[model samples]
Target: DARVTQTPRHKVTEMGQEVTMRCQPILGHNTVFWYRQTMMQGLELLAYFRNRAPLDDSGMPKDRFSAEMPDATLATLKIQPSEPRDSAVYFCASASTTQGGFSPLHFGNGTRLTVT
Candidate 1:
């Protein structure tokens, strides 16, 4: 299927537990991104990628969250010792860079994480 896919659509975990979310972008898209959505902040960027190499992850908290693209299709977001405040809908998006510029983003439904 030509669609972005996310695993464990709903996750509930205890405080301080480690949580991992996985994504598979639409095949052949070269760029991927991770973003988190909260009621107050809306959508916040939390990842980085350009041709399979991390470009900028400054939007995410360096201490707890990590975003990585191990290969072209797979991207992962992880929270080590997750906290209650970390709850949110995490989305994965992919796009192709055009010579003309500005390709549309295809996003997965998101992994909803709730830490108690």
Candidate 2:
């Protein structure tokens, strides 16, 4: 089955700590997405990349969070000086695109992060 793989399924950190999450997207997919889920925000798209290139990341805090694709299969998200408000589940998803649109995305189980 085609699936996204993520590392460090859970993390607990004190405020001001740094947190890093990694993902491996399904092979042959050209689109990668990062999302954050919280009680207040529900599900918000943090970043979007096409063909391993970042398309948008305005939903995330620029000074604290960053997302990147080192290659086609790997995607990484990092948060520096993490805050209590950053406690949430982060998800990585992969999808194929057609005619500039997108196909159905396959999502990873998610990484649960807690910042105290």
User: Best candidate, TM-score-wise?
Assistant: 2
Q: What TM-score does structure 1 among the candidates reach?
A: 0.95
Residue pairs of candidate 2 with colliding backbone atoms: none
TM-score of each: 0.95, 0.97
lDDT of 1 by residue, 9-56 (tens): 999999999999999988989889899999999999887687889888
lDDT of 2 by residue, 1-116 (tens): 88899988999999999999999999999999999998897999999999988999999999999999999989999999899999999999999998868899999999999999
Candidate with best lDDT: 2
Candidates in order have lDDT scores of 0.90, 0.95
Worst 10 residues of 1 by lDDT: 97-106
Clashes of each: 0, 0
How far in Å is the alpha carbon of 8 misplaced in model 1?
1.2
